[model samples]
Target: MTRTDGRLQVALVALCAAVFLDSMDLSLMGVALPAIGRDLSLPESTLQWLMSGYAVAYGGFLLLGGRIADLFGRRRVFLLSLAGATGYTAGLIASGLLTEISWRLVFFLPVPIALLVLAAAPLVLPRGVRPPGAREGFDAVGAVAVTGGVLLLVFALTEKSWPAGVVAVLLLGAFVVIERRRSAPLVPLEVFRSGTVGAANLAALAWACATIGWQFVAVLYLQQVLDYTPLTTGLGIVPMGLAIVITANLAGRLISRYGLGRVAAAGMLIQGAGILLFLRAGATGDYLTVLLPALVVHGIGNGLSFPSLNIAAVAGLPDERQGLASGLVTSAVQIGAGIGVAVLASMMTLGGSTLAGYRIAFLMAGGFSLIGALAAAFGLRPRRPAPVPAPTV
Candidate 1:
């Protein structure tokens, strides 16, 4: 391969690996939460906060992070995040193996990794030729408003606080006003004018809500209802992860052939079907009969839909705005996951029986997936841009 090809390949691998590690870090807590709670002697409420707090922090600053990436450089921000995530993962693994570790270790483990990434980033990533005027200052007020607004919203959902939600709405409204007045907004409002970007973000939000909510239910069913060990529970979900990895690559090619909107809609429909299948699960149902098939189907849908939505979101964006586009997509995923966990988990407890609650939660999640499918089909319908004419001499 040529030098340019080699650099591109490296960049692709690094970025993909970063995303993979980030996802794993986020998800590792699901199956392990009970174990962590027991070891730390924590209440269920505290455990809940630990899980939701990560999503809040991640989602809240994502737009700001993107703006920072655009201002400083994408490579720098990515390397920093990746390194911190890696260290955090390592610390978690260590805590698992060792006995009687302090719970605070879990929260502070990423600090060392952040420092290491700070030192090593220049050597690991390629130095690109900076775009002209790339170092423009960011909109600090707009950034603060949006970040605070998203955090409050996420916190309200997680904690079920109506007053916080109202405050969040006000803050977000202020963000819009500030962005309009700013010389250079953190996120250029014009990007939302593109149907593709808007639809992709909406679809991503719905997909995350459904899938994360389903997974939360599945974990509870496996451990609490079925009485499986945590290790066994983790092992049982391996096939779903493998299916996602395999199908995601295949979906990229399918997008090249069928277009983004069609593939995304199909994926969502398939995922909804998977969740609908879970309605058959009962207190006495076996994993093989009730859960495995749903897991496989859901995995396939995730693999197909997520990549297509991502491609669609960034399809028409200029190079300089790519970081912002990516951040928006990532933010949607985090926020949706937070909302899903809060809403669906509550549904699971409000019904007559555990089995009944599970069924209701599954139905709601499935409905969200179907809604996403409809949105993808109609809202993201592709409109190829007209070509600019050749310039006259």
Candidate 2:
């Protein structure tokens, strides 16, 4: 591979790892919440904030992070964010909330603070100290919408049903309006304008939403319904991670040959299939026969689609527009995640039991994935690269 290609590959891998660990860390803490509550003297009222804080912090600043990278330097911003998060973690540990600070330290500090660094790193590296691009500017608006929606969602989270949902819808509509009107909009109008690109991104949003939703449901299924310990739950889900690694390599080679439409359609199909399988899993089903295989398929689908979707979404954009392209993709991902969680939260409230909630979530995931599959199959028709301008004779 060429040097630049090598860097992107290496960087993408690292970025994936960082994002993975960040996600796992937040999940891990949820797994450990019972222990934390027992030891820290945390008030029942404030306990959920650990997860909420991270969500808020990560979602809140992602666009700002992208903008900073666009205007300043990505490498520099990443380095600083890394340093800042490290320091934040240290301070968080030292604060000793169990003795004094309590939920305030545990919930509001380390998790989000660390993520602020993690979120900033990707944006900074891609854009750097240069023009962020018209599309990027557009995506920044999308970023704000994403952040506002998250905040409103979180603020309204742990509350009654209708009120939270209403707030979420309103904020989402406001965000969409802002995105449409902004000159250098947060997400490029063109992204949505291009049928292939638009379809890919919207499909990505659905897939991501379903991905996060299912993962959330799966963990709850293992822990709350089946009464598995946190470690056991983590072990059960480990196969999916392994599957993603193996499948992504295979998908990379397949994409240039098959086209993004076929690959993405396959991804959505696999994702929907996985969720369908999970929905059928009873409180007493065997993990190996049901959950394991489903996860493996789901992981492969995600791995195949993730990188290729990025490639397709940004195809044919000018170099100046690269940052905007990246931002749009990033914003879509974050917004999808937050929306998924909110939707699942609503389902859980309606169902009451962990299993019932999980069933509802899996169903939603399956439906969304199917929609994504349909979009991929029908919406994308690949275009040949535009002819280059001729050199002067």
Candidate 3:
């Protein structure tokens, strides 16, 4: 209708497009892992790092990224990030097409995306009201501490190195202390005081943990156990992706009616039910009977829960703290993903048999989803309608 509205719409489109590309990249990698491992001669232990490493870095820096967006301008950061991501995606495409390549390429795939978002500082984005004095509050020490801590923690989990884990704990402790002391902390400790924000983040973390873990196992099961080719595996999962997309569009309207907590809780429960369906699947299971149903259900749950969680996270935050809220929620997602993959993968390998391990992992995932559903139910509050102003005489 208006120029501002048009610009906002364009900006939203761009953001949505960027997110879609990022999601596509993740899904593609999941399907391609078996092929990459075979081609690069990577072991299962090392293969797990491909996802975990990205999760760690992405999660660890999310707060910092949000802080940067607050200080430097969200538009600038977003554009820069998109550009960097585009470049990395191109590199990944090239690597994927090559006959001979190293597993290291897979690890490096998300790096460019990260850098692109960072470098997008110069690009023009929709103009909006800026938070006053946002630049003055940056916490350098806290950033380093948190980032290093998360990275080391994830590395330790993946590599089974206790020493690194200890170091990670210490660094994270230092981060807490640093944040407590800072006048303008990267993440205001006060935000966690809100039940809604805290619960939403926790639910987000749990959701990611379950879904990502399930995805890791599912991909392997399809390729290794079912003996499907990479292309076939990817194609097979397309329905799930489509389901997620379709349901996500519908979720917003549902939330508008049912509220975030109800929608999110219901979504989580549905998702958990879908994962539970996998318990019946075995080595001899077929795609239609064993995987498709679970996939569709899981997709529906994802579509509903993700948007609801996001809305709940920032529902009542001041504009000034919006960036921090976003960062915190995203960090939860990344951390959950990293932890889930590490824990579930370990369970799979440690189990007596591959099929047994897969079952265990799926069960654990379902358990986490149910737990998240409970959290969403108890923690989140419904949005209140805005008051209407009286008409002037």
Candidate 4:
């Protein structure tokens, strides 16, 4: 391959490394939560903040991130973001192994990785490509409103703070008004005009809500209820990860043949079924009989659904708006994930972390997937071809 092609590939790796940091942290933190809680003497509600805080920050800034990339430069923003992604990729297993050492070490593990990524980013990522709207003013008001609004909303739901909830609502409402008035809005209000974009974003939100919350609970179930060690808890989830990797290879082909809507719908239905299967999990639940099958089923569904949702979210949009579409969908996923974890955490505490509470959380997660399925199946339907005029006419 040419030097240019090689550099481009390396740049892709750097970009993907940052993204892996985003998704992997969710699971890694889940594995560490029980240990973190035990060490800190924290409750379920508080333990969840570790996960939700990162998710909310990631979600809230995504739109602003895209806008920054456009205004500054993609490579510059990527390098800046890569600094944050820097951490040990070994967090999955390391979170377990390190938590044994000290739960604090788990948080420290990523520092070296970030430094390495930072050192390499300047070398790998290309420079000099500026977006058309580089001169446009930043939407500072919209950014603050959305970010603060989501933060407060998640805080309210998790902590049961009514006053915070009220402020969150007001801030979010103001965000809509602010965006509408801006000449170059953080997110253009017109993107939602397309049926596919709207539905696909909704589906993406629900999918993240169900899966992230379920993942959080699954780790707790294994470590807390089933009495597995942090290391064993980390290892136990391997089957699902394998299933996702295997199924994701096939998901691309399925989307190409069946289209985004059908594939997403089918995937979500399978995911819902998988979560519902956990309804049978008990205090004395058997790993082989109960958790293993559900994990694999859920993983396969997750693999299929994840990629399609992003594609559907951007479908039918003009080339210029593709970045905005991507940002919007990712924001939906992250925000939904934060809210889902908060909701499930509340459910678990309601039953005092008993098997009944776990069951309720799983049921609610399943319901989220079902909502995703409906959005994908109906909302993402392909538009009909416009009729051609007769030759005579």
Candidate 5:
């Protein structure tokens, strides 16, 4: 193979590793939350913030990050972002082991790995084809307003603070007004003119809401309701991740044959079914009969739908707006995750028994997935048939 090809491979691996780390961190935290709460004497409401806070921050700033990537260099921005992601495929098992000793170690797992990735990034990641000009018209007001609004919105939902919710609404409204006036907005409103981008983003948002909320509730159910240890909980969750890894490898081929809309909608429907199965779970639920089957089904559907949502969001966009499209979809996911977790956490406080609350949360999550399925099915524009060539032979 050529040296250039080898370098590209290395870059792909690095990017994949960073993504893995980010994903694993979320899962790892879910498993570790119970342990952390017990040790720190925190409640479920406070524990939910550990996940939602990250989601809000990540979602809120992504538009700015995307714009910065356009203004600065994508590679540079990528490296900077890599500094934050921590954990990988083994994180679930590792988190279990570490939490047995101390929960702090689980939080620290990504530090050295992140440093190593950063050290190698400069060598492997390609530089931009063109340097950016001196005049950079970044919409600072829009960025701040949006980010602050999202933060406050999450806080309001989580804490049930009406004042914060009002402020959040005001800030978000101001952000829209600012974006309309700005020369270079963080997110160009015109991008939504394409039905595909809007629908895909909406689908992604709902998918995240269902998937993230289900995970949060499931983790709690395993530990608090079922009285499972951290190690057992992680091991049980491993099958779902494995299923996702396997199915995601095949999703591209499936999408090629069935088209994004069908595959995406089918995946969401399947995922919704899987989540609904969790409603059968109770204090005496059997892992093999109940949890394992549900998890595998959910993972398969998640793998199929997740990649399709990302691709659909950027499918018809111009090359220049590709970064913006990516950022917008990702922001939708993060925001949806925050909202889902917050809403589910509130649901968990309702009903007479803890088990009842969990069932309610699972039901709500399933509903979210159904909504995502409908969006994917009906909102996305179908691809037109290619022209047939004349028989010239």
Candidate 6:
């Protein structure tokens, strides 16, 4: 690895910080879903779309975001993205359109803007720029295939009229055929061939869907089942925020010392256990017992594993391909969380009280996490080969 000058180091840190904030912002809504849904008179089915909508918008455009970022510069796009994301998130908080509100604003607005800024960030240092053909990257066919598969999975969870899942699957199958023949792909054909970064990313996506999606369902449980107010539901998730803050730094260090594979697996497994606790929740369950404990465990799980996944996703890429790798890894996370919340939310029914629906969601989260664990165990190796360093973008 080459040494970074002060400006490059600052830029990296700034972008990473923005990523953390964006990540938190995305999950924060899940914590309020129950209260928000009840207040808005939304059905569980409708709630599912709220999550899914953001995901579709984000996933659909990820490739373009990365490509643009590579052309523009990472720093510039990163800052602009931050501005747009902050603005749009505020819009979601303030908007009163109800279901008519566009989820696209919620998801697509920020990252793409960030990518644009990121693509432009390299202006600070002349050395940061790289010539084209330094290495081949961006597997277009792979991008289509992955996108199709993801969208299909998301569609399968939806009860919408469009049957988007079927289309997604067909598109994905076709994408697979395309990738086999294409030379420069969006997702390198070789990356998918490896169990480590590729599979870990997949597991990260699944785990994210389960863990991050919980806020929506759990919040609903608090308000609908326990009769907590919106403010209170927000407060309920506050503990999760605190836990993340406290543990993320520690998790980073643990990954440094113990390696990401074993540590991330443990974090995910523990989170799965936390979801099981939610399954045991009842209408009359105490708040401290049922809610706080589960969130603590879940939060710890998230804190421990997240950074590792981020690092893993771009581990072996050549220097110039960093932007693509970063974009793909992040796209997977947002898309996964979006789909998980959407699909699981669709499963919610009024057949039982808030407690009942929440239980099912938690179980679903656990299943996702378990799948992540298996994928991580088999695919994600912590001993990353030296990175193919990114251009300034």
lDDT of 2 by residue, 1-393 (tens): 787787677677656655665566555665565446556777423445555555555745655675565555556666676667667666666666545754334344445545654664554346534554523332555666657667666557545456765776787787778767876555445556778677777877777668875666576567656778767877887888788788888887788789888887887788788778887688886888987888888888787777766776677455555555665565556556655655665666567675776688788888888887887777766777999999999
Point out the higher-scoring one by lDDT: 2 or 6.
Answer: 6
Please report, as a residue range, the 10-residue window in candidate 1 with the lowest summed lDDT: 102-111
Instruction: Specify the highest-lDDT model's number.
Output: 5
Q: Kindly list the per-residue Cα lDDT of model 5 for residues 155-195, writing each as its tens digit.
A: 89888999999999999999989888877788889888888
Task: Please say which candidate is ahead in lDDT: 2 or 5.
Answer: 5
Ranking by TM-score: 4, 5, 3, 1, 6, 2
Instruction: Evaluate model 5: give its lDDT.
Output: 0.86
RMSD (Cα, Å) for all candidates, in order, is 4.0, 5.9, 4.7, 3.3, 4.5, 7.3
User: For candidate 6, which ten residues in a row score worst on lDDT?
Assistant: 102-111
Alpha carbon deviation, residue 21, candidate 2 (Å): 4.2
Model 5, C-alpha of 323: deviation from truth (Å): 2.1
Question: Candidate 4 lDDT, tens digit per residue, 280-348?
Answer: 888877889988899889999999998899888877687666667778899999989998998888888
The segments of candidate 3 whose C-alpha lies over 4 angstroms from its true place after superposition are 1-5, 87-124, 382-393
Instruction: Show the colliding residue pairs in model 4.
Output: 86-114, 87-110, 87-114, 88-110
Candidate-wise lDDT, in order: 0.77, 0.67, 0.81, 0.85, 0.86, 0.68
lDDT by residue for model 3 (71-92), tens: 8788767766666656766676
Best by TM-score: 4
- Clash count per candidate: 0, 14, 7, 4, 0, 38
Residues 1-393, model 1: lDDT tens digits = 898787667656655555654575557767777667777787544555555567756875787888778777777677776666667666765765476554434444444544554555555577665555456677777767776777777668656799999999999999998878877787788999988888888898898889887777778777777887887988888878888889997997898899888999999999888889888777776788777898889889988998888888877588888888988888888877776776677677657987888888899899889878987998778786799999999
